[model samples]
Target: MSEPRWLTDEEQHVWREFSVATRMLQAHLEGQLQHESNMPHTYYEVLVALSEAPEHRLRMSELADARKSSRSRLSHAVSRLEANGWVRRESCPTDKRGAWAVLTAEGFAAIKAAAPGHVEAVRESLFGPLTAEQVVALGEISTAIREGLSPRCAAAAAAAEAESACAGEVPEESFGVA
Candidate 1:
């Protein structure tokens, strides 16, 4: 194998800070959702995706992709949400193995209830410390890094956009970073 390129001192420092920040933010949000919203952050994201989709539904695979989730992981989450009456699965008539994740009325209401606290948590943990200029810069930096790291990400994004269900713009309330 070829020798790996080593990070410079500054690169190393930036990477460490970025890694820690992402992990800490995720942990903070996860704990907040579990404690205050009575749901995991992952489930909340699923509900939000479905709630935003047309007819409050998306194909199972699409949902998994949107959430960066494995098939089995998404399936497990759907099962848990199903038990909570927050989501339901409907088999596709045209494709036997295909299925849809549909948000129930209860799910919509749950998201509605959970959203305020969730957004607040995000703002507090993520945006509260940043100035407006810093926020914009961070968003740009994040997107540039993401696009650089994953060559197929743009293609996947375009596919999601063509489908139009899984890639809708987040409303201003969600901060629209996505």
Candidate 2:
């Protein structure tokens, strides 16, 4: 293997700034969520993803992928959500071997109740500090990053799916049309 190329000085500075900004943003968001909603950032993300999903439910494996979380981590989170009466795990009728995590009525209620505060927090914590031009720049930057990363991400997801099938942990049919 060859030594990796070093970042240019400007690249290094931008990289460090990006890392710091990401950490600070996450900390601010998580702190606000905990204070106002009694929910962690991760839990809020899980709920957000589910709320946007079809029937407010997603296959457990798909949820894990969408959340960029591991199956075990999502399972534990869902278990906690279940205990809170916000979510429930059910076996998929279409696939006896598969399971789904469905957002409950209570979960929707909780999200509805929390949405205002969360949006306010988001605005105050980040966007409020930015000028309109800055917000546009941020959106452009995010789109670029997403466009650059998406193909590699999709390929990796496909590879992981193939590996899971080979390992007998997930059947290929799991990716079939819902």
Candidate 3:
């Protein structure tokens, strides 16, 4: 086998800093959401995804794919949300084995109430510390990284572009990765 490639000192330093920043940022966001909204970051993401979906509903498999979560995890989360009166599951009329997650009016209210604080927390923790140029660069860097990591995302982008052209509507943001 070929010898393994190793990071140089400078590369190592950059990698370490990137790892720490990612971890800390996630932790801070999760904590802030939990404290302010009484919901975990994942739950907030689910609500956001559903809220943005057409008719405030998405197929369960599509939701799972968007969230990058496994079937079991999504099922459990949906169960919890259902218990909280934020989401309800309905059997797909066309597919007996398929299901859809529908956001309720209560869920809409919950998201509306949570949005301001969540946005403020995100602003304070991320954008507040970065210059405008840095923010734009960060977005570019993030998209590049995501595209590199997930080939499917590139395909999805192309599909979205075609769909957008035909429908005359912009694709909604996918909150699954966040």
Candidate 4:
């Protein structure tokens, strides 16, 4: 194999900062969601994804992909949410092998209640320290990184948009963070 290219000092610094920031941001968001909403960040993400979907539901695989979670992990989280009366699983009508994750009325209410606090927490954790221009830059930077890391996400998103359009529902353009 050819010798691996090493990061220059500036690249190293940037990478380290990005890594640490991601770790810290995740931890902070998890803590905030857990404390205020009685759910972890992952659960919040699942609910948010479902909420943004048509009829507050999505296919299990779609939800798993949207949340960037393993199927098993999503299943477990859905179970927990089900136990809390926040979400329920439904077998897909057309696809025998497929299932759907539906957000319950309680789930909608719960998310509605939790959203403000979650937004505030996110703002505090990420955007509060940044200038307006920096926040704009951050959004661009995040989108670029996300696209680079998961090229398939863009295609999936496009497919979702087409599906939504056909179904007479508008696709959510932004990450449903709450």
Q: Of the candidates shown, which would achieve the greatest lDDT relative to the real structure? A: 2
All candidates' TM-scores? 0.82, 0.83, 0.83, 0.81
- Tens-digit lDDT string for candidate 2 (49-143): 99999999999888988997756677778888888999888887878768888999999988887788889988997899899999999999999
Q: Could you give candidate 4's per-residue lDDT for residues 1-178 as a string of tens digits?
A: 9999999999999999999999999999999888988888888988999999999998877887788875566778888888899998887677666778899999999999989999998899899999999999999998998879786865775686578769985233211211
Alpha-carbon lDDT of model 1: 0.83
* Order of quality (TM-score): 3, 2, 1, 4
What are the lDDT scores of the predictions, listed in order? 0.83, 0.84, 0.84, 0.82
Off by over 4 Å in 1: 152-178
Q: For candidate 1, report its TM-score.
A: 0.82
Question: Ten-residue segment with the worst summed lDDT in candidate 1?
Answer: 169-178
Candidate 1: which pairs clash? Answer: none
> Positional deviation of 14 in candidate 3, in angstroms?
1.1
Ranking by lDDT: 2, 3, 1, 4
- Where model 4 places Cα greater than 4 Å from the true spot, the runs are 152-178
